[model samples]
Every structure is written in C-alpha cells, then in structure tokens.
Target: MSLWKNRNFLLLLGGQGVSEFGSSITYVAMPLVALTVLDASSFEVGVLTAMSSLAFLLISLPAGVVVDRSARKKLMLWSNVGRAALVGVVPLLAALDALEMVHLYVVAFFVGVLTVLFEIAYQSFVPSVVTKDQLVDANGKLSTTQSLSVVLGPPLGGGLVALMGATRVMAVDALSYLVSVVSLLLLPMREEPPAKTAGFSWDAVRRETAEGLSFVFGHPVLRKVVACTATSNFFGAMYFALEMVFFVKELNAGPLLIGLAISAGGAGGVLGGLTARRVSTRVGSARMIWVSVLGLGWTGVLVPLAGPGWGFALIAVGLFGFSLSAVLYNTAQVSYRQAVCPPELLGRVNASVRWVVWGTLPVGALVAGWLATSLGVRETLLVAGAGGWLAGLWVYFSPIRGMRDVPTTEPVTA
Candidate 1:
C-alpha cells in the first residue's frame, strides 16, 4: 500500500510539499529582511518570532472547536487563502517602502491565527484520506517532504535574497499557498461533520477547551511529552530566535553560506525521515523518543561553539544533529498520538496539545530576545542548550519510557 498510489493522499502530499517549500524560503528571507534591511536587533527578531506563535496560544482551543464542528476541507481551503493574501502584503509594502517592524509583527500574528486553524483541520482531515495502518507511513512521508523543503528552501531563499532582497522573497511563499489551495480543490474526499452543537457560547468554548486539557493531563505519556516539548521549545526559542544573528553577526557568514549551512544540516533531516519508521521499529518507538530528544539537546550545544569558516561547518553538524533527532522524535510521537487518540477527539486533543506545547514558543522567543540583549548571544544560546537537554527529564521519568510502542487497540487516556 504505497501512499504514492493513493490519489487523494498524493494530492495532499503535493500541496503540502509546494507550500512547505515556499514557507521554508521565507524562513531564511524573513530574518535577513529584518537584519539586513530594517537593521532589527536580536531582541526584535525574538519578539517577531514570539509573536508568530502567540496565535497558537490564543486561538488553538477555539480553532479546535471549529474544526470539530465544521467541514475541515472548507476550513483548510479558506485558511490557505487567508494566509496567501496576508503574506503577499509583506512584499507589496516593502516595495513601497511602507514595511516596518510593526507590519512584520502584525502580519506574523494574523498569519499565525490562520495557521492554527489550517493545522488543526489538516491533521484532522488526514485520517479520513487514508486507512489506520498508513498513519506512520503517511506522517513519515510528510516529514520527509518538510525535510526536502528545508534542504531546498534555504538555498533558494538565500539566492533570492542575494539577488533582490529578503523582503521580495516572500512573494514566492504567497504563490505557494495558491498551489496548496488548488490541491485542496482537486481532492474529492468528503469530510464527516461532527454532531451539531446547540449553539456557540462562552460556556461551550470553556467546556471544549477543558476537555482537551483533561485528556492530555490524564494521560501519563502524552502529559510528559507535552511538558518535555514545551520546555524544550521555551529554550529552543532562545537559540533559534538569535540563530541568524550568530551566523551573520558573529560568524561573518553571507546569506548564501547561511543557506548552504542550513541545507547541509537539512540533509540530516532527510536521512532521518527516510529512515524514521525503520529506526523506530528496530529500536522501539518509545525508547527512541527520549534518546532522540536528549541527542537533539546535547548536540545543539555545538552551534554556539562555532567561530568562522570552519566554525560554520561545526554549526552545520550541530544543525544536522538537531534536525535528525527532531525528525526521528516527531515521526514516532506524532504517529503515536494519531494512533492512540480517538478520532472523535482528534481536533480538540491536537489543538489542546498544541496550545500547551506551541504556546510556550512566544514566551521562549521573548525570553531568548531578552537574554541575548542582556547576557550575550553565545551565553544565551548556551543557556538554551542546557535547557534543551533538561526537557527530556520529564519524559524520562514518565510511563512512556517503559513502553515499547504506541498501541492502537485502546486510547492512551484509559
């Protein structure tokens, strides 16, 4: 049962592939725009990054309610359109010399808002397009596409930035959304609607949000995973928020070099993803989680040690390790979550988990910015590295560490 043969799944794969590629380009372009064009400091970049995740914290639960109650295909389609239009505004304003830090922040926030809905809908939608047996393979393939984007995007984005400017590179991302929109339009699958609610009210919102929280907190393994990931994201934000600063300001690397290094590191993710299921199956998915998480954190320390030409190479290795470990851990965990959770609760459960895990990103970004300003780039990153390693401790002590694999027979919540 190769997913490639599944016409509907292929459409999803194609759409996400193109969209992720565009988004990856912006990953490099956005920071460069702020740094090279606007002269934004590390703190500002941190704030910008944090703002992007703030919507996850604010709207995730509500978005989950919508996803559970509404047609996911429609939700995903309109969200794509919304994000496409929003991203286009950046380049347009930049060309007119109207772009500012505030514009970037606002755009990031609103885009985040749209992204939350799209994410919840997409995750909920995927299961309907494929059989239960295909979840791991499906998720792995998706991760592989993301890795490919990481490999292709940074280099492409760097070239675009080198030629025109970082601000102009966003147009490509805008177009990528349309590609996704078309794929959605092509899909012939019908989503099953949830039971109709009596009416939307503040009480319903609270109850739904609470139910998601209760499920996660009640589950031992999921709770640990959420805590560990949230903690890591908090510290990882500090490291990532100022990563470009370290490369350009400290290492004296150019945009092309930055892209190359990122791409080089992405190669590890590609490898990790291609082999994710194989490795997880061999080693046991549960054990692999802690192993990968610890490896991600410890190896991340190598980046701060980077100095110059050769130093960039060292940093690339660190990035490679981080990406590799992340792919392995994500493939295992995401598949586990998808498999064990009841389909009926998918939207709320996923949204609630994201709200807790991704919610920490804003705080992390803000803290990273403040730390970089007050302590120093290397010092802040060093602290982040330490914090990253510490995140695994929560899961290490959890029931998950003793398990072998994710079970499909019963909900983990039980």
Candidate 2:
C-alpha cells in the first residue's frame, strides 16, 4: 500500500509538518530574539539552551508514563495547545516592550516541557496508525517532511523575522501548533487501551522503566544500535557545539556563508530521507545503517577541512547532509523496535531508548565547550570527527551487520 493512501497518517504527518516548521522558525528566532533584541549575554543564551534541554531530560520518563495511560491523540492535542500558549508569550511581551531574557528563558523552559510530552506521545502513536509493514515507510516519510521543514524553516523563519520582527514572527510558530491540534483531532484511529496498571505508583513506574531498559539492552540488535547511536550523538554534539567557532575562526565565514552552509545540509537531509526506503531495499537495512553512519561520520571529518571559501564550505555542508545515516537508521530502527515491543510497553520502551540516546547530548555539549576553550576550535572539531568515525565501528563489528532482513515475528532474545 502506498503511504499516501493512508488518511490518518497523512493528517498526522501534515499536522506534525506544520508544527515542525514552526519549531524550525523558533530555532533561528529564539537565539536572535535573545541575542539582538534582549541583549542577552553569551552565558544567558547558553543558559536558555541548557534549560530547554534540561526540561526534556527531566520530563521524558514521566511523560512516557502519562502517554501510556492516556489517549495518545488527546496527549498530542493538549501538548500542541500548551506549546502554542507558551510561545505566544514572546509576542505579547514584545508588544508591551517588556520582553526580558528571563522571560525568554522561562518561556523556553515551558515550551521545552510541552515538546517532551508531545514527542513521547508522537513516537508511541506511530505504530497504532500504520501497519507493521508500513512502519519503516511511515518513518521515512515523516523524516522526509521533517527534513523539508529543516530545509525551508530557517530561511522562511529568517524572512518572517526580518519582515515582521522577531517577536511577531513567533506568532507563526504559535499558529502551527494550533494547526497541529486541529489535525490531531481529525485523526480516525481508535483510542489506545490504557496501561494495565492505571494508577500511578512509584514502584510501578520504576518497574516499567526498568523493563523498558532491559528490553533495549537485552536485545542484541537493539543493544548495538543504541550503543552506536549514542556514541554518534555524543560526538555529533561536540561538532555542533564547536561549529560556529570553527566557521568564524577557521573558515573566516560571515552570517550569509554560515546560513548557506547550514542550509545545504538541510537540503541533503531532505534528499537522503526521500531515498531512504529505496536505499534500504537495495542494500539491505543493516548495510544501509552502516553506510549512513559512515556518511555522517565523514561529514564531521570534512567540515573542518572545507577551507575559507563559501563555495567549498557549501559543498562540504551539502555533502554533510547527504551523508547522514540517522534518517535510514531511525526508519529501520523505529520499525524494528515497534514491531518487537508489546503494545503496553511501547511508550516506556521508546522513552527509555530516547533517554539513553539523547541523554548524552548535554554531556557532549559541555565537554565540547570545555574542549573548545582548551584545545582551540579547529582541534576540537578534528577530535569530534575522529571520535564519530571510531564510534561507527560499534555497528561495523556487531552482530547487527549480519541481519539481512527485518523479522516478521517477535525477536528472539539472545
């Protein structure tokens, strides 16, 4: 069955696309808002970012439990509404000429909390709307949309910010969340059954969390996938933390060049996401994942070497996007995980895996910051690139490399 033939999936995708594009806008607008309008110090900008991520770390597990016990659609709707309300404050404050860095930080924190809830619900809901066979395709399609938003979002966001001013541009983001809420309400899927243990208890939650962790760690394929992904994220975070410094100092790039280089990667990601399914079918999922890792790892290697010219940097960034392995890896891994996990365990399992995978980001960011301060920007990037490449070896040497096809039945425990 063609992916487009599924009405509910289309709605979900459309709604999410709107919301993600808005998020893309905020990605640019927020820093600019803090930096230019509020005159936020570098430390304050860093604090705002750290606070937002801290919300994700703090809220993900509890949000998983709530998602498991609630109607997934309702969770999505309310989360969108909540995010809309949180983001709206920026514009309101701007209108009053009362916007402050503290206000932005608080709003960012609130939005971050809502995003965590939405993401937990969103990941858990995918399996319910699409068939097992369609899982990879669905994820691929979603990735494509997300990549498109990344490609379009920043520039569109910059334009909106430029035309309407930063505070007013946030209204576009708020509207997207409202659109998402409406689309979610229109989805036709049956409500998921509540968790068997409905009442919240610390012991029960802890046990559920433990079970999710065990499932991921206990499975041979999942274990290797998580290890490789987590390591890659750590090194990738380092590269990102140092990217601006590398661009300014090493490449002697200006804002226009930086924007062009970043946009090229987004374009590559869109192309890669679109081709994920075809590539997986031709090369096999496991091999495709290995290829993606290598591609991504090499992007890290190539960036620092791209030199001072805008042309060289643009090519390097585009190749960097093209080389991303996560689009395929996620498409395959999400399908594999959803198929193997029991229905009741889906939320926690998804959350557990994310907690481990994304949990490394903050540490990586901090380490990169420290390293950049001590080792210099170019040297830091080189370390990140080399480390990312070495991390790919986890997939290369593991049993995951031998799995030629996704299993149709429950994965056997090793």
Candidate 3:
C-alpha cells in the first residue's frame, strides 16, 4: 500500500508537518527578535544560536538509551508538550513587556533538549511504522513537507514580525506544537516497551553509550559519513550565524527580504526532497550521498559574492544550492543508516550519529561569533562557505566512493 494511504503514516506526517512549520518560523524569527527587539550584538546572536543546538551535544547519547528502553510515542508526546509550554513562555513575557534576551536563551536551550529527545525517538519510530522497502519513500515524503514548511514559514514569519512582533509570532509556533500533540494522541498503534533487563544504573548507561559509539565509529562507511556531516554542520552553523546580520547590514535588507532570502534555501530543499527518490534510483543510493555534495554544495560561495539590489539574488541562489544538496545527502545517508543497523540498536545508533554530527553545531556557532567579530561578517561567511564545501572530500576519499550501493546486511557491532 502507498504510504499516502497508510493511516498511521498520514497521521505522523500531519503532526510533523505542523511542527516543522512552527520550527521554521522560529528559525527565522528568533534571531530577528534578538537583533531587532533586544538589540543584541553579533556575538550575542551567535550565543543564542549555539544554545539552541547545544543540548544535542550534552544529552543525545542518554536520549538514545532512553528511547531504546521506553515507548517512543510517549517520549515524542512529552517532548512536544514540553516544547509547546516552553515556547509559550516567550509570548507571555512579551505581552507583559518583560521579555529579555536571557529569557530567549533559556527557552532556546530547553526547547533544544526536548527536540533532541523527540527527534531521536522519531527516527527510531519510522522503521516500525513502514516496511523496509518504503524507507526512502517515507523519508522523502517527510523531508518534502519539512522543506515546504521552510519554503513558506520564513516569509510568513517575516510578515508576522512586521505586522505584529517577533515575540507574538512565537505564539503560532506554540499552537502548532499542540497540533502535533493531538496527532500523536490519535495514532492507532501503541509501541511496546523494550524487554525488562537488570535494574538501571550509571554503569549500564555508560556501557550502552559506549556500545552505540562503537557501532558507529566501528563501521568504516559510517565513520566517514559522520566526519563529512560534522564538517558540513560546523561550517554551516558559521554561515547561518552571520546570515541574517549580513542581509541586514551588508545587503541592506528589511524583514520581508530576509525572510524571502531564507525561503530560497527552503525552495531548494523542496526540490531535493521531491527528487531524492529519483536520484537514488538513477545514481545508486550510496553514490547519491557523495554526489549531491560534491556536485552542488560548492555553490555556497555565491552568498559571499552577493551585494546590493540585483547582486543580492546571489544569496538566494547560494542558499538554494546548499540546501538542495544537504537534503539530498541527508535522505540517502539516513536511509542507509536505517537499513544497516540492527532494529534493537537503531535508537542508540541514530543518537550516536546525531551526537557526533550535531555536536559540531554549537561549537561552530561560537566560533562564528568570534570570527565575525574579529574578521567581519562577510569574511567570516567566506570562510564558512569554503570550509563547508571541502567537507565533501572526506566521503569522496572513502570506500563509498567506489561502491554503487551500500551493504544492507546488519553490521556486526564492535
């Protein structure tokens, strides 16, 4: 049966679609709120961005273990509820004229922590909901909606910020989370908990965490993919750290143009998602991973080349290419991971991969702040673009470069 006709899959997509829309709004609105409302400096913006992803570094390992042991649906529900409550605080404070940068920072961090929990569980849950043959199609459909939200949300967010205020725009995000919670509640299947084992202890967690790490690093292709993704994320964070600042100060853009510029990238993501299955079929799934990056990611340089008026279009073009390649790469690689790992360890392995790859984001944001302060925004962006493109080289030199397809057999965990 087509995933479109699958009731459970449709429910999952509906919930996630709304959630992604909300997140995309926050993605553009949060920094604008800090920059325009609180009058935060470039360094402060970087810190704010760093705080959002830092939770992945701090707790993703443990989150994987928890997902493996508990009911993924329950974890997802709790995560959505927590994030909704946390985002709601922003609008409440704003209404009272009590909003502050510190408040945003706190909200961003805690929301990030919940996001880590939700995402790890979400990835692990997908395989259970669909057959192995449906993995690529399932991910492509999911990515398409996520990309579409990015395409539409940023422009709407910008308009909302202009018409109302950035703080109030967060209210929409909070409402969206409630929608996701309701969707999860309506799903027909209940996930059974993992079999009981010895009583939980710090020692057990430590061993399990190590086991996950070993499984990822022990696999030759996974380690290279991790390296490539980490490098891209590290530099991608730097590019994004200065992206809005560049639009405002360098290109002299207003809120609407800023939103539109960001949306261009989302447009690219939409194309990537829609084409991922076709690309995988023609290029070979494993080959599609590196091909996407090496062929398209270098266009990221168009951003730094952008100027005022007509030249400013270059930023959109650059963002489009980068996002397109990123979505393509992610779809292929994530499906690859899902295919190769043991079902029992999927949660841990996914978490382990996220831990290493996403860990670079906060560090990159911090570095971007420092680099922007020292080198200026445009120069820092140049560095980010060049470094991010170079990351593809890691995979190009690995065994995946020679393969037509990745091995589907379960890997023997080290």
Candidate 4:
C-alpha cells in the first residue's frame, strides 16, 4: 500500500512535522531570547545549546527501558504536552518581566529530557504503524517533512520574531506541540503487542539497560554502524558549532548569505529524503550505507576553502553535501536497525544507538570551541571536514562492506 493512503501513518507524519517545525523555530528563537532579552554572553549561549543534548547522555538508557515497558503512543503524547508547557513558560515569564537565564536553562534541560523520551518511542513506534517492507518508505516520508520543516521553520521564526518578539515567537512553538497532541490523539491504537516484564524494580532497570547496550554491541553490523554514526556525529557537531562563526568572521558573510548557506543544508536533506529509497535500491542498501559517506561525505572539505565574493558558494555546497549524505545514511541504517532487532528489544536498541551517537555532540561542540580559540576557525573546520569523511571507514572495514542488501529479519538467537 502506498504510504499516501495510510491514514495512521499520515497522522503520525503530520503531527511529527508540526512538532519538528516548532522545534526548529525554537532552535532559532531560544538562543536569541537568551542573547537579546536575558543579555547572555556567547559562552552562555553555548552552554544553553549544550543543555539540550545533555539529557541524551544522562537518561537515554533508562528511557529505553521506559519505552520498552510503556505504551509508546501514550509516551509520545505526554512528551509533546510536556514540551509545550515548558516552552510556553518562556513567553509567560517574559511578559511578567521575571524571565532569567536560569529559567531558560532549567526549561531547556527538562525539555531535553522529554525529547529523549519522545524520540525513542517515536522510532520504536514506527514498526507498529507499517509493515516490515514499508519501513524505508515510512521513514523516508517522515524524514522528508523533518527536512522540510528545517528548511521553512527558521525563516518563519525570524519573521515572527521581528513582528512579535522572541519570547512571543516561543508561544507559537508551544502551540505547535498542541497540534501534535491533537494529531496523535486522532490516530488509532498501535497494533504491536505490549512487551511483558517481570515487573518494575531498580535491579530490573539496571539489568535491562545493560541488555540494551549488549544487544547493540553484540550485533556485528550494528556495532560498526553505531561506531560510524558516533564518529560522524562527533565531527559533524564540531563542524556546525563553528560554521556560523567561520562564515561571519572569516568569510565575511552577512546575515542574508548566512541564512542562505544554512538553508542549503535543509534543501539537501529534503533531496536525500526524496531520493534515499531509490538510491538505496539502485546502489543496494548495505552498500549504500558506506557509499553515501565515502562517495558524497567528503564534500565537507569544501567549507574550509570558502572565502569572500563568489567563494561563499563553497559553504553552501559543502553544507548541502554533508546534509545530503547524513540523511541518506540515517534513513538506510535506521530502517536496517528496525528490521533486524527483536520486537521486544527495539526500544532499548534504538535508545542505545542514540545514547552513544548523540552523546558525542556536546563533547565535540566543546572541542570545536577550544580548537577555534587555539588553531583558528578556518583551521578547526579543516580538522572537522577531514575527520567526518574518515568516520565512514568504520562501516567500510566491517562485514557490511561486502554485502549488497541488509537482512530484514531479526538475527536467529540461540
């Protein structure tokens, strides 16, 4: 069946799209609110950005346990509701002239916690909505909108910020969550059977978390893919942390050009989503995983080559290539993971991958900051560009290197 005809999938896609669009708006507005209203310094803004990813490292293992045990749809609904309330507080505090940087910090941290819960459940829940064969198409459709939201959300956010205030713009973000909640409520219940446990206990949580980590590392293909993703994310985070600073200070790019360059990444993501299934089918899914990175990922090297005048296009092209390869790699690998993991362990397995991969982001951002101070922004980008391309060698050297298509069924257990 065509995903366009799948009503439940459509609801899930729409809800997530609305939610993603809102988050992208906050991505722009949150830092601006801190910088303009709370008078935050550049260091403080960096800390604020780091706060959002901190929960992934801290609670992702426990979150996997929660997703495996609970109703994923229910968890998603509450996660959205919680995010809405947390984001809504910003504008309310601003109106009362009581908003502080500390308030933003707390909100950002707690919101990150909810996001961890939502994402794990979201990935685990997809299988229940579609058949095993539809996983790629479903994920690709979801990715398309996610990329589209990133493309459109920021410009709308900047405009809304100009017309209404950064704090007020957050109100719109909060409202987007409500839209997600409504869409989620409209969907029918998921078809997957609930996972049974020996009941909840601290010991059980510890054991379950360990099981998740073990499952990911024990699988031959999963281990290598996770390593590649982690390495790529680590350096990718570094590249992004310095990208804007490099453009403004080194390339002398104004706001208009800067926005255009950032938008190029979103455009590339859109293309990747639209093309992933076709590309994977042509290139073979297993082969495409390594091919996407080794083939297209090296374009990040173009970024450090950017300069004044016509040279600014290098930044745009580089970001476009990086985003394109990332979305392609992610779509293929996520589908493979979903197909190969045991049903009961899906939540835990997905969380384990995210924990390791996303855990590196904040660390990489901090490293980028130090590198920029030590080696200079342009030179730091050179390190990031080369490092990102090399990261793909993890899968290249592993068992997946020779395979054409990946297995769609869980590995047989003893």
Candidate with maximal lDDT = 3
**What is the lDDT, from 0 to 100, of the residue 388 in candidate 2?**
77
TM-scores, all candidates, are 0.97, 0.90, 0.98, 0.93
Question: Can you write out model 2's per-residue Cα lDDT over 1-414, one digit (the tens) per residue?
Answer: 677998999999999998988887777677778766876643455466656665656766766777787888898899899999999999999999999988987897788788777887898899888887777778888988887777788777767766777788888899999999999988877874686545689887887777777888888777887888788777776776556555555666544455456666667767777887788789775576666776565665677666655446644563445445556767777777787788787887777777777766666766776776777776777787778777768877877688766665764543
> Model 4, range 1-414, lDDT digits (tens) per residue?
888998999999999999999987877678778756777654565567667777888989999999999989999999999999999999999999999999998998899999999999999999989988888878888888988887788667767776788899999889999999999999986555567457889899999988889999998889999999999988887876666567655776644455567677778889999998898789987788899999999999999999898898897899889889988888889988888888898899999999999888878877887777788888888999999999999999999988987676754331
For model 1, the run of ten residues with the poorest summed lDDT: 405-414
Please report how far candidate 4 places residue 84 from its true position, in Å: 1.0
- Structure candidate 4, residue pairs in collision: none
Q: What's the count of clashing pairs in each model shown?
A: 0, 1, 0, 0
lDDT of 2 at 165: 78
Clashing pairs in 2: 292-325
Poorest 10 consecutive residues by lDDT, candidate 2: 314-323
Model 1, 1-414: lDDT tens digits are: 778899999999999899999999999998888899899988899988998899998999888888888888989999999999999999999989999999999999999999999999888888888876677778878888999999999998999899988998999999999999999999988777576365888899888878877887888788898898889888888888988998889888898889988997688788888988788788776677887887575888888988886767888888888888888888777777788888878889889988988899999999888888889999998888788878989888888889887675655564
Q: Which residues of candidate 1, in runs, are more than 4 Å off?
A: 410-412
lDDT of predicted model 3: 0.91
Mark the regions of model 4 whose C-alpha exceeds 4 Å error after superposition: 191-193, 247-257, 410-414
Per-residue lDDT value at 313 in model 3: 94
Candidate 4 similarity to native, TM-score: 0.93
